[model samples]
Target: MARPQYILQPVNPYFIAFSLAAAFLLNLLPWGKLPGIPDFVALVLLFWNIHQPRKVGMGIAFFLGLLMDVHNASLLGEHALAYTLLSYGAITIHRRVLWMSLGVQAFAVMPVLVGTQLVPFVTRLLMGASFPGWDYLVSGFVAAVLWPIASVVLLLPQRRPVDPDDTRPI
Candidate 1:
């Protein structure tokens, strides 16, 4: 029996930049202040970091996080710290994680999402800020749930074109 062949597509840097920008803009929307809306910027960042480690990494995540912190009017380094950690986690297990099914991928990324959420929570707690309650966790859950969809959507551009002549790929 012939094994399945995976066609690898070349990723365009512009597409990545555009998606991250869109995610940042989405994060700027008021929906994030709601109970269940996940951090869109973090989500997009993780997606790219996992699938395109060479293209997206801690530096990009940190910069975006700083932008988010400024936009959110929160402590300057809070989001930067969280996103940097998240990016590190994503890149750490990206190869292993992407080989699994979407459901498994969702579960695999929980640690990264937790880190992203936990940093801000811990920072606020240490700063004597009031507890945000369990509702804050809802965003992580929501990001997990959205993983499959985000994965599929973001992968669209990475789908390789069919090669008519090549029946079996080495």
Candidate 2:
């Protein structure tokens, strides 16, 4: 049998806002400083970038990045630059990504996710901050691991009903 295809409904803007806000709030939690804690906002932003590029563009990523900079008390544009580039990369490959299996998709996004972490990391190093060690890059991989889960959860709102009537054998 062929794999089932889903025709998702149009995404609601309000749901998008709520997911972004929730991700930011999750980032605000204290556990965020720990290594391997995925960047929830980055994950959410990338999800929307892939699935709804027109709806969530680089502007929103930049804004969230700025907010993160303020919250982390780091270089003002560090995260802004990283997130904006992440958004750009996601949007660029969104079409190709949509066709992949969840496992393949995770690998596809790994580079983008890791690069998002690298931007801030290299920025800090250039500014003379001490090395944070390789662990600093762990979150990116963690975020990639969460990609499949994030895809499922975020797409929940748009998933069409599986129920089929005789006239519509979906």
Q: Global lDDT of each model?
A: 0.88, 0.95
Question: Mind giving the per-residue lDDT tens digits that candidate 2 earns over 6-96?
Answer: 7888899999999999999999999945899988999999999999999999999999999999999999999999999999999999999
> Which candidate ranks first by TM-score, i.e. highest?
2
lDDT, model 1, position 152: 85
Q: In angstroms, how far off is 115's CA in candidate 1?
A: 1.9
| Model 2 accuracy (lDDT, Cα) | 0.95
TM-score of 2: 0.95
Q: Give all TM-scores, in the order shown.
A: 0.90, 0.95
